[model samples]
Target chain A: MDAPTEHLPNVAEALARAVDTRASRERDLLGELEALGAERERLRVAILSLEAQRAALDPIEAEVRAELTSLDDGAHEVLFNSLIAQRAAVAARAELVAEAARAQRDAARETTDNIDALLVEYRQFRDVIEPTLPDLPATYRSVLKAHHDGVVSRLRQFFSRVGADPVPLDAPALDLDVVIGVDGDGAEAVGVTIAIPVSGDVRAATLEGAPELELTLAARVVQAIYEGLDAIGQPTAVTAFGDHRGLLVVEVEVEPTDRADLVDQLLGIMEDVLGTSAELLAAGVRVRALEVPADHLFPPEESSDTLEDAS
Target chain B: MSEVAPEELIVVPLAVAAERLQIDPFEFMRLLVMMGEVPATLQISEALIDRVRAAAGIELWWAEDVLLPTDASPSRAIVRAALRQLLERGFVGARATRIDNLWRGRPEDEALLRRAVSLLHREGMVGMSRSRAGVVVSVSPAAVPQLDAAVRGESMPAALAALA
Candidate 1:
């Protein structure tokens, strides 16, 4: 029995944010925009306050000096004490105003520090939300695509190990399609299957009207790819068939990465085991790339045994 | 179809009967149908072992002689049938083309036969002769041992030992 995808929260709506990478990017842009607005406002207010303090510094100093000088100039036996007291009061009020402004600047600095920490968390929030979001078709598609590429990369490494060069292919163009399936009662996709299509052609005879021959060839190709994959320590479940047009289609259980290059490598193995292209053509076996039915691509792992090898 | 083996008969399918007799499956099908061994529907190709035991000079497949112990390919079986047909009739043997004409598109058995013939010839199990017979193929002297191993599904080294 398969495990339900309940652990993947909001799975049906998984790609609500993750799928549209543009949306997450837009969110990042919004965050940066907000940070910019806040910092700008902070700097603007701080700058205005600094200007106000600088402007008030001169006036306060002049007022204190003028009052003190008057008290000094008016020093007399009876008035001296009262005038000096008034001077001390004026100086204390000016110092209190300056100290309050300094405290306001310290408070502004602390707020900026808090905002800085918030911006760090906002970026991390983007990171945290992505994987926790439910998985959707696009998630599988992208991962399968990577897995497909990894298979090609692995194949290339395999060839390089032998100091041999394979017939280069635009491997990304090779199909490793992920098929999303929704259960009968489930509202969204719950399962996936991987498809890898291969083309089979015969130079001498047509397999179009010959279902048995097509199936035979299809079986051979499947055996070839299966062995190739196993040789690389990448054994996987597979189902393959030949179509009415005598083309071959393969489905494999989903994996973290693909061994898709086995399809390409298989032609080489077949050519070696069977013969050269001309010899193969004479024997009515031609391997190439082609399309397959989307409807048939995603059979379950057990399906390979059920295809009924009529050959 | 008058001959009968001395051994007890066992239940098996017509195809297995054909395999056991070293005869082509289609030819065996025809032989069984003609002798009223196969039903009209043709869906049921199963019959008693006695039906096949009734067809040949020898004690037939499972009778006190060696019967091939493994599942042989249809093509290999066809090749054997061709040899048996010539031996029964006391002929030198027939041309590959003659077999092709008789078997074309009948389940694509001709293609299989062609590959089989090529492989057998390459392995020196089929001989070519000229002159009085005027260019025809006959089973090589080594064919029996080689084909014995062939039908038994022997491994390459053991099969090589058989030829050696």
Candidate 2:
């Protein structure tokens, strides 16, 4: 072995041999891989054939499913139509009942409204004729209407004396709405009772008058009545005594309260309107302060007092 | 320190010299004896004060500049420089003296005194004295502390006392 010459064919020759070995192994691996690839191709083709068979049966399967679905749809449509017809029948019956209820309600409302209208008419009728009814028999509806008229007349006379303008009787004045019972017992004597509103001041001015002036005003009242009756053509025959004058000796009737009001009305009329003063010139004017026999001529009717009382 | 005769020794108190020169006593002594206001001994008395006062009235003398004592060396230049600085700063003033031995080589030292007077005026420490002399100056009740403060550049221990 005499040392193989020439450096054993250089490093390139050694590297080329190793590459050729790797290339041979790679070619053998390529051959085996080509065989495996051929087998895979066959298997893939078989799977493709099976997939084609499954695809070929898809339409028949879908047709059968569709036939079943149509059967179900036919049954459901029958049931749904039957239910819709039943619901419409029930709703129509309920609507008829509701319409009947609405008609009944409308009739009830109309009946209530007609009753209210009749009540209003009756009230209006009552109001119109109530005042005249008091002059009728005791069986008349109520006595308030006739008594109200008398009070209203007195209030008018009071205002005229006090320099207040006469207003309509229906004006809203707070007054006692009196109710006077008619006797109707055929003596033809009509008795009156004043209602006298609650806590009203009928004698307030008298309470404020001095005792002497109160007596003096009473005397003046008697004189004025005598003079007023005489001036109105009801010639009053007055009889005089010691410090006394009698307007009426017999059949003279007047409440002290009423006489006071009458006196105030007369004096107010004289002083406020005519500026003429009237005085008593005496002490207390007692109804029985002086005695008189029944021989005097009495005042006839149509005197202002009689006329005012009649009204 | 020779034992010279008393009259020749000029034994006037330093305070009298200060009054004559119208300066602070200590400062006048510092300018006269210690600093050598003269090259030779000189007499000092009330006559010297009269001389100085007459010179002050005539406007012929101001005492602060010439009265400073100095060394025997010939360094008159240094003394002159210090005097010039003092004059510029208003610490000294010049005064005229007799050229003979009676008042020779003594500089008037009225700077501190003039300043003290001005300070008194500023502090309202000088008041008018109604004497025969017209508008004479007398010490006001404030003189003690104010003058002391002006001299010492510090407030005095006691304030001005009320006059009896």
Highest DockQ model number: 1
What fraction of native interface contacts does model 2 preserve?
Answer: 0.00
- lDDT by residue (A157-179, candidate 2, tens digit) is 32223211111222221211111
Q: Highest TM-score: which candidate? A: 1
Which window of ten consecutive residues has the lowest lDDT sum in model 1 chain B? Answer: B1-10
Q: A179-223, model 1: which lDDT tens digit per residue? A: 112122223211222121223232112222221222223333344
B-chain TM-score, every candidate?
Answer: 0.33, 0.24
Clashing pairs in 1: A147-A258
The window of 10 residues in a row where model 2 chain B has the poorest summed lDDT is: B95-104
lDDT of 2 at A233: 29
Give each model's clash number: 1, 14
Query: How well does each candidate reproduce the native contacts, as fnat?
Result: 0.00, 0.00
RMSD of 1: 46.9
